[model samples]
Structure formats: structure tokens, C-alpha cells
Target: MKKVFGILFVAGMVAFASCTSATEATEDAAAAVDSAATAVDSAATAVVDSAATVVDSAAAAVK
Candidate 1:
């Protein structure tokens, strides 16, 4: 009975460790996705600003 209990305890520990690693990997992936989204938003804003500048310059020239 004692040997069986020890074996079970070790198995449980191993299971828990594996689950923790998986959870960490999932969190890291989510963080990476969020970072990429932020980068995309920033790039889009820069493009819009550049376009606006060009339009303003053209309007001034026409005036």
C-alpha cells in the first residue's frame, strides 16, 4: 500500500508540472499576439498620418 501511494504521488507531481508548462506556453503565445496587434495598429496610424500630410500639401499647392 505504501509503495502504491508513493507511486501515485510521484505521478501526480509529474502531471501537475506538465500542466504548468503548457499554461505558461499558452500565456506567452497570447502575449506575442497582443504585441503584434499593437505593432499593426501603430503602422496603420503612421500610414494615415502620411496620407493626410500629402493631401494637405496638395491642397496648399492648389490654393
Candidate 2:
């Protein structure tokens, strides 16, 4: 009886550990996606700013 109980406890612990690992992996993936989105947003903002600067320079040259 004791041996069966011990085996069950160990099995339960292993199952919980695997679930925790999977949760952590999912969180990590979400974080990576968020980071990538931030990078893309920043790059898009930079492009817009650069285009504005070019337009301003052209206007100045024309004036």
C-alpha cells in the first residue's frame, strides 16, 4: 500500500512539473511575440519620422 501511494505521489509530481514547464514555455512565446511587435512598431515610427524629415528638407530646398 505504501509503495503504491509513493508511486502515485511521484507520478502526480511529474505531471505537475510538466504542466509548469509548458506554461512557462507559453509565457515565453507570448513575451517574444510582444517584443517583436514592439520592434516592428518602433521601426515603423522611424520610417514615418524619416519620411517627414525628407519632406521638410525638400520644402526647404524649394523655398
Candidate 3:
């Protein structure tokens, strides 16, 4: 998955570099990195939240 993401990022960079100005490419790359980071954080948060919920439910069932 990470490899795929890296490939996509690199592909996007190449495409942007070919088509747009450096300043625009830089801005877009930065924005894409930020968006990807946020998405990872949200996915991690969701996984943690889901695990906690499962654990809580198990504990409740035991009691």
C-alpha cells in the first residue's frame, strides 16, 4: 500500500513538473503531502478507536 502511494506521489510529481510551473508544483506537492498525512492520521485514529470499542465490549460481556 505504501509502495503504491509512493509510486502515485512520484507519478504525480513527474506529471506536475512536466505541465506546471515550479511554484505551482511545489504548492501542489505540499498540499498533497499534507492531505496524505491527514488521511493516515485519520485512519490510524479509526483503527485505535475500533480496537478500544471491541475491547470495551468484550469486557462488558465478561462482567
Clashes of each: 0, 0, 0
lDDT of 1 by residue, 1-63 (tens): 999999999999999988765777889999999999999999999999999999999999999
lDDT tens per residue, model 2, 1-63? 999999999999999988765777889999999999999999999999999999999999999
Q: After superposition, how far is residue 28 of candidate 3 from its true place, in Å?
A: 1.1
Q: Candidate 2: list runs displaced more than 4 Å.
A: 1-21
lDDT of 3: 0.96
Clash-forming residue pairs, model 2? none
lDDT of 2: 0.95
Strongest candidate by TM-score: 1
How high is the lDDT of residue 24 in model 2?
Answer: 75
RMSD of each: 4.8, 5.4, 15.8
Task: Report, for every candidate in turn, its global Cα lDDT versus the true structure.
Answer: 0.96, 0.95, 0.96
For model 3, state the Cα shift of residue 53 in Å. Answer: 0.6
Query: All candidates' TM-scores?
Result: 0.63, 0.59, 0.58
Show where candidate 1 strays beyond 4 Å.
Answer: 1-21
Better of 2 and 3 by TM-score: 2
